[model samples]
Target chain A: MIQAVVILFSVLAIGGALALLLTRNVLYSAFFLLLTLLGVAALFVLSSADFLAVAQIMIYVGGVLVLIVFGVMLTHKTDPLNRSNQKPNAVLTNHRAWLWPVLLAGSMFAVLFQMLRQGNFVLLNRAAKYQTTVDTIGRQLMAEYLVPFEIAGVLLLVALVGAAYLAMPERN
Target chain B: METSTILIVAALLFSIGLAVVVVKRHAIVVLMGVELMLNAANLNLVAFSQYDPDRLQGQMMTLFVLVVAAAEAAVALAIVLQVYRHYRTVQLDEVNDLNN
Candidate 1:
């Protein structure tokens, strides 16, 4: 049952990512990213990191995806007439320089897959002891991980301020 | 599903993300690719956390990663907006003022 769910979401994630990569229209790519983020969130749930899964949805899907869409809308030069005309080629791109990235990512995956498939990786049995992660995460965030947690808070504040400053319109 | 299976899926996702970052010309699309890559790393951390179970260090790191990724995305998009303002275009190849 869980395995089926994992397979389903993984397919969703990978397939959506592929679509995101191949899509020409910047708006379409942003929408596809939302699909990919949701799939990753589901994958998190399947892995029993319930807290992480929720965070993924809230942060990635809710926050980041919206920001990306806003960037797309703000940056892309839109045409009201073209909108009505609906030309198929909204944003055409040349793929002539794809060889390097394909070779780089492909070789990296091949090496990692070969290593993982060698049966040398150590994996502990977590299902027997699996429990609600929220409590554990809460405690750790307050105790052992307190410093980093605080730092992350400060970082987020800085990012918030910085984004507002950067995106603000110029003064007269 | 085996741990190896999960890892392989992550690898595939990460590679596709790399491809997107490399191939895409639009800054926003490249940002999406970076997000995909970050999610792949987060998946690996969570999967390994499942294995350890004792410290749950991987889960903690994943939380930090989520925060950092959000921060990165926010700043990156801001920069993209600024780029668009300066260049009047978002195509990375065309925004080549630094090349000369």
Candidate 2:
């Protein structure tokens, strides 16, 4: 049962990711990206990392995707007939471009696969001992990783301010 | 059926992300590609966390990566909006005023 779920989630994630890359329209790509993120979150849950799964959904789906859609809206005027202009002919023209990504990704996967195959990665048994709940993560955040967490918060605040400053209308 | 399957998915996601970044001219599409890449990393982190029980470092790092991705998306989109306002187009090729 667990294996089936893992396979399902993996397919969803990889499929959604392919759709995101293949789509021509930026808006459609963003929507597909949401699906990809959701699928990855499901994968996290399947792996028993519940806290990461919830955080993925909340932060990526809720927050980041929303911002992306907003960016799409702010940048482009909605024209229903502009579909032709949105087609990905430019990207498809250069067949040679695909070569590098294929090679790099293939090599990396090969290396990682060999490493995993050699390593003793006991799955179900080890998952039983880990505490991957939200509370446990929260506790760790406040205890051992407190300083880094605080720094991240400060960084986010700075980013918010910077974004507002950049997007604000210029007044004469 | 196992960790290898998960890794395969992650690799596919990473490659697609690279393609999107390279092929797409729109800044938003590039941003989406970055998001996909980040998701791939998160998948690896969670998968590894499952294998090791003594440390939840991967999960915690995934959380931080999420926060960083959020911040990056927010700031990057704001920059895109600003660029559109200045030039009235988001096409990467046409928006080359800074090319010099």
Candidate 3:
């Protein structure tokens, strides 16, 4: 059942990613990106990374996607109905650009496939190990990794302030 | 069912991300590409973490990556919006004023 769920989640993730890539409407792409993030969060849960999953949903879907949609809204003056017309000629040019991504991605996959086949990964039965619960992760975050955790928090606060400053309209 | 499957999925996600970054001219699309790449890395981390019984460091790192990715997306989009206000377009080719 777990394997089945993994397969299903992978399918969802890949599908949402593909949607994000193929959609021309920026809003649609953002929504699909949300789907993709949520699917990955589900995968994290399946992997027993429950805290990470919650963080993923809260941060990426809730925070990042909102930022992207706001960016779209602020940048584009047209309503959704007319925004499609604003596609720059450069985007429409080079119709064969799709082939480049396919080729590049294919080569990357080939290399990674070879590496994975050669590597040694010991897979243990999930039932045998003690659960990696959120409590343990919280304890570790507050202990050995405390410095980095606090540093990350400070970094995020700085980013928030910087982003607001950069985004504020210039005064006349 | 095997580790190879996780690797394959990760590779696919990475490639899709690369495609989005390379082929799409919109700044938001490029940001999506970055997000995809980050997710690919997170997937790899979780897959590797599954191999160990103790030390869920891989999962922890994935959490950090997600947080950083969110921060990156927020700042990047804010910049993109600011740029659009000045230039009216998000196409990379046209925004050449900063080019030396």
Over 4 Å off in model 2, which ranges? A78-132
- Poorest 10 consecutive residues by lDDT, candidate 2 chain B: B47-56
In order, the Cα lDDT scores of the candidates are 0.83, 0.77, 0.77
lDDT tens per residue, model 1, A75-114: 8665556675545536543443778988998998898788
The DockQ scores of all candidates, in the order shown, are 0.70, 0.56, 0.58
Task: Choose 2 or 3, whichever is better by lDDT.
Answer: 2
Model 1 ranges off by over 4 Å: A79-96, A124-129, B98-100
Worst 10 residues of 1 chain B by lDDT: B1-10
Work out the iRMS of candidate 1. Answer: 1.7
Best by DockQ: 1
True contacts kept of each: 0.74, 0.65, 0.59
Estimate TM-scores for all models: 0.92, 0.85, 0.88
lDDT of 3 by residue, B1-100 (tens): 5345666778888988888888788787788889899999998888777655356778778777876887787788878977887887877677789733
Best by TM-score: 1
Segments in model 3 whose C-alpha atoms lie over 4 Å from true places: A79-96, A123-132
The predictions' CA RMSDs to the true structure, in order, are: 2.3, 4.0, 3.8
Chain A only, candidate 1, TM-score: 0.87
Worst 10 residues of 1 chain A by lDDT: A121-130
- In model 3, the number of clashes is 0
